[model samples]
Target: LAVEPDIWFLDEPFSALDPLIRREMQDEFLRLQDILKKTIVFITHDFDEAIRLADRIAIMKDGAVIQIGTPEDLIINPATEYVAEFTRDVSRAKVFSARMVMRPLAPDEKGSLGELLKHDVKVQEFADQAVNSEDRIGVTDDAGSIIGVIDRQSVLNVLVGRESAGSY
Candidate 1:
């Protein structure tokens, strides 16, 4: 079927597929989104799939929307115990973005954002590189402007869940 609605509401589009095919479709869907950039109202019960596909996720239970947040926000600061339990087994480094743990650049670190990563990068994507570098990794904006910095320690904190609540 060919539809051109302004918004796409996909309810468990991959539910019936085998796990391998579902994963392949997930990858293909993500690739399509990178090009289409459509406003998609994708519905799924799989937390891992939701985390993988969403820029923001709205979780519902018993037909009521329970919480809404990015993957990192939901993982790092769940709104309730129910939400916490849902995120408990997620590898935080793979879920949290650089924006969640980055600090403002110190005076001595001016003009250094080019030395590291963009603010939107996932923490796990750069963890190894950050750990091996002597200085903090710089997070930048689309305009090539420095926004924040993240150190190996901060990245490690998220990996180990050592950061106190509300620290992000």
Candidate 2:
């Protein structure tokens, strides 16, 4: 019988597979997630593997979701000491994107610099752009008004952990 369901609740389905095979299955599962758009309830003991797959991870302690969120939410704001320790091994740079660090471009700001840097572009991606540019890029509001400016120096400072980096 052909068995296909809208929602798949897999409980340690790949537990017996070797690490390499398990990784392949995870990739296939993610591909399915992209196409099917179904709710998945995947159970796993490996925290790293869980982080790699689940959209909204629900860390269970005593059969309850201690915390539930995307990987960022779990990393930035861990629920308990265990969760915190679990996320500590993860590299911050790998998890954080450029959009998180990028400031907006402001209007009435006459500069070709800002025009080149797109919103939510990664710091590393923007770093080269910032270096090549001459004028300071103005961070604009939703209404196209100048709110902040991102210059080569500012971008550099933010990337190297010297300055506070975040989204607007």
Candidate 3:
């Protein structure tokens, strides 16, 4: 894809899409990135999406970068909590990979639980599902390694229950 495009600028490629399709496109975009690591200058007004895709996100203001860093860096040490608050809405467990959050699964750990969501997907995504499952949700890397397990109940408490209450 990169070799063909001297420069590619998609103007809100998913802007017109319905929310569900837009989401599908976002996932598709991530999948494409695996095969083509292009230097892209994707533009979007959505902070959540920007942080999701960017290796180094530049939060722009008035035609300049107000801050630029990896998602974790920005979240943990926002230039200000304003940025932190913006990031807080995004579930770190979902957006970050197993490599970022996972401890090595013990050798004795065993069980073929059902399919877990992608490690790259936000934990907030699993909040509802977690509430229903008594067992831990497996976390896997892109290489398909069973790196860790997410405590389902914990995710529900953080992403839904506490999060909604904290917003008030």
TM-score of each: 0.84, 0.61, 0.62
Q: What is the C-alpha RMSD of each candidate to the true structure, in Å?
A: 2.4, 5.3, 5.3
Q: Give the Å shift of residue 44 in candidate 2.
A: 1.4
- Compared with the true structure, what per-residue lDDT tens digits does model 2 show for residues 63-98? 777888876677777889978887676644444444
Mark the 10 consecutive residues where model 3 has the least summed lDDT: 159-168
In order, what lDDT does every prediction score? 0.82, 0.66, 0.64
lDDT of 3 at 66: 72
Judge candidate 1 against the unseen true structure and give its global Cα lDDT, from 0 to 1: 0.82
Residue-level lDDT tens digits of model 1 in 43-118: 9988888988999999776888898998877876788888889888888777777877898888888765446577
* Alpha-carbon shift of residue 56 in model 1 (angstroms): 2.0
Worst 10 residues of 1 by lDDT: 110-119
* TM-score of model 1 (CA atoms): 0.84
Q: Number of the top candidate by lDDT?
A: 1
Task: Indicate which candidate wins on TM-score.
Answer: 1
Q: What is the number of residue pairs that collide in model 2?
A: 10
For model 3, state the Cα shift of residue 148 in Å. Answer: 1.8
lDDT of 3 by residue, 1-168 (tens): 636774456666777889999899999998887777666778887777777767877776568777788876776567865676677776665554433443445666538455565666665566566667776667786887777766654565454424332221
